[model samples]
Target: MKHIVPVKWLLARLYESDVVIVDCRFQLGKPESGREAYEESHIPGAVYLDLEKDLSAPVGEHGGRHPLPDAAELTVKLGKVGISNDTRVVAYDDQGGAMASRLWWLLKYLGHENVFVMDGGFTAWKNAGCPVSAEQKVLIPARFVATVQHNLLVEVDEVRESLGTGRYVLVDSREAPRYRGEAEPIDRVAGHIPGARNLFWAEGRQADGTWKSAEEQRERFADAGLSQDDEIVVYCGSGVTATPNVLALGEAGFTRVKLYAGSWSDWISWQDNPIAVGDEEARNDG
Candidate 1:
């Protein structure tokens, strides 16, 4: 499944036994807020998914705040959340696709093929005037199968090689300031890959905070002179926000998009690795 399956399309499949609708709306500073809003009202039968609590492993000084969860524990989370091998999972968040996209990537990384992010997210759902409810969902335990798909992800070494010849198109999906290295919000370093292009994930959305049509998104990425079929890779602070880019790229009909799972955080951890800050910065540290 491509990254986006429209909200209306999701409404139709809400009752399918094979479908698992995960509400991934979350806030970085206010971790409890996502659950509060979810408990207040959510799509009927939708289960709340937390980025920091559910999607990530324990945090540490070296690893970014949201470290990748171990597969053994992830299987347990999936089982409790009603995600089975047959599940077609759908994820959404209020702020564009920020938190939801993380699940979209995690599901795929864990080798589940039936998952997609709700384009435009909950905002689009409300605008579309869909139904909402305050009732909590009851889940029946289900077996969640997981197998790591390493090809779906790349790392610092892979990034270095990609930069060696500019053969890989590295796309930065952070906000403008972060992408331009003008602000250091999360990571200690401030900059982007030398040959990378910025497409701020929010730009992939509409004025109403919904994703643009697939065709429009295609044109926007194309404006950056990216070839649709190239070996395109995406990244953000810690392989979290870039999931939207992977989703948008798939929606834009790109068949070979990949994510740098370790992302900038991992890149910066390598002491000998090269670093570039602003635009017009040299492509290689050497």
Candidate 2:
């Protein structure tokens, strides 16, 4: 199946027996806002997945602000949400795919290829005048067996070794200000990985919050000096927003891309890892 589905297409298949819609709306400051919004109204039959509760494990001194949930626990959660090996899952959020892509990536990492992000997300669905419902769905539980793809994830040590190696391209998918160390709203330390290059995750979206075309995405990656053969590793503040960049890279036809699951939050958890600030040019050559 496609990586992304348009609102119209999803509307047409809203009630299909094999489809599972997930509402992933969330705010960093207001963690409960997503569930509140989902309760008020959402796409019909869509289940809610909390970013903090459902999508991530409790944060500790390490592993960034958001850590991957245990595979067995995730399998249980998916089963409870009516997702099975054959289910076609669609996830969405108001913030483009920033929140939803995490679920999409997690599903793929669990070896579920039928998962997709709703292009343009809830905003587009609402604007299109599609029907919304407050009725909660009570789905019969289905067993979801997860076969983890371990190669899709990387650790801090691996990232450190890859720096300036020319064999790997370390990508920081946070905003410009955060990457340049001008301002840090979340993590303790400002700046990014020493040799990492900045590629804002939001660049994957258009002005209307819709994803850019594959052609445009290819151009964006080309402008960043990336080729199809680059061994790319992407990370964001807490490993959340980076998933969208991961999706974008895949859409652009890049074959080898992995997620730095701990991201900057986990990087700064230990003081020994060097952090860099200022313009991209001022940083160490990678």
| TM-score per candidate | 0.91, 0.97
Candidate 1 matches the true fold with a TM-score of: 0.91
Clashes of 1: 0
Runs with alpha carbons beyond 4 Å of true place in candidate 1 = 61-63, 281-286
lDDT of 1 at 16: 82
Write the residue-wise lDDT of candidate 1 on 1-286 in tens digits. Answer: 3567788899998788888899998987899999999999888889987888889888664445577888778888998989998888999889788888899888888999888888778878888899999999887889987998877877677788767696798998887788778998888888877788888887888887777888998899889778976999998888788888888888888978888867778777777767766663334344
Look at candidate 1 and give me any clashing residue pairs: none
Which runs in model 2 stand beyond 4 Å of their true positions?
282-286
* Candidate 2: residue pairs that collide: none
Candidate 1 overall Cα lDDT vs. reference? 0.83
Error of 2 at 248 (Å): 0.4
